[model samples]
Target: MIRGMRGAITIEKDEPQIIWDETVKLVQAIVAENNVQPDDIASIIISTTPDITSAFPARSVRMLEGWEYVPVMCMHEMNVADALPLCVRVMIHVETTLSQRDITHVYLNDAVKLRPDLITKNV
Candidate 1:
């Protein structure tokens, strides 16, 4: 089955290094939590808040070893009043036997506030 794993992380500033570092951190966490390999990932869609224009998260993801062939895209999240800024979010489509309820969705740093209800009971 193809499952979508969601994750998000917040950066302290809109710097290229910070964006890349945090994006890598978020992806690593997602991969570790789910035991997914590069070949298992179908595609990754990354979105950053409008305030974050310093870098493209896709650049960071594609640079990961063995992820060069994985399809990935990056875009800016819709800007909403009072919405979280400096945030990077991702939806990774992967081939997995794990049920939807068992899939872990990671939210790190201040982004954890974005999904307070995503805690998986099976973990």
Candidate 2:
């Protein structure tokens, strides 16, 4: 079955290095929490808040060894009023046997406030 895992992380600033580092950290946590292997990933979609224009989050994913074959895309998140700033969010689709209820969603740093219910149960 194809499953989707969601994750998000907040960066302290809009610098390229900080964006790259935070993106990698967020993806790493998602992979670890979901036991996701590169081969099993179908595609990864990343979005950042409008303030995060220093770098593309997908660039960080491609930097990971063995992730070259994985499909990844990055875009700007909708600039909604009161939305979290410097936030990067990702949705990873993968082929897995885990049921929806068993799948884990990760929200780290200040992004954890985005899903308090899930944090208490899954993160």
Prediction-by-prediction clash tally:
0, 0
| Deviation (Å) of 8 in candidate 1 | 0.3
Candidate 2 segments whose C-alpha is farther than 4 A from its true place:
121-123
- Clashes by residue pair, model 1: none
Q: Which 10 consecutive positions of candidate 1 have the poorest summed lDDT?
A: 114-123
lDDT of 1 by residue, 1-123 (tens): 999999999999999999999999999889899999999999999999999998898999999999999999999999899999899999999999999988899998888889889955322
lDDT of each: 0.93, 0.91
State the displacement of the C-alpha of residue 7, model 2, in Å, after optimal TM-score superposition.
0.4
Report the lDDT tens digits of candidate 2 across residue range 1-123: 999999999999999999999889989888898898999999999999999887888998998999998999999989899999889999999999999988889999999999887884544
Give TM per candidate. Answer: 0.96, 0.96
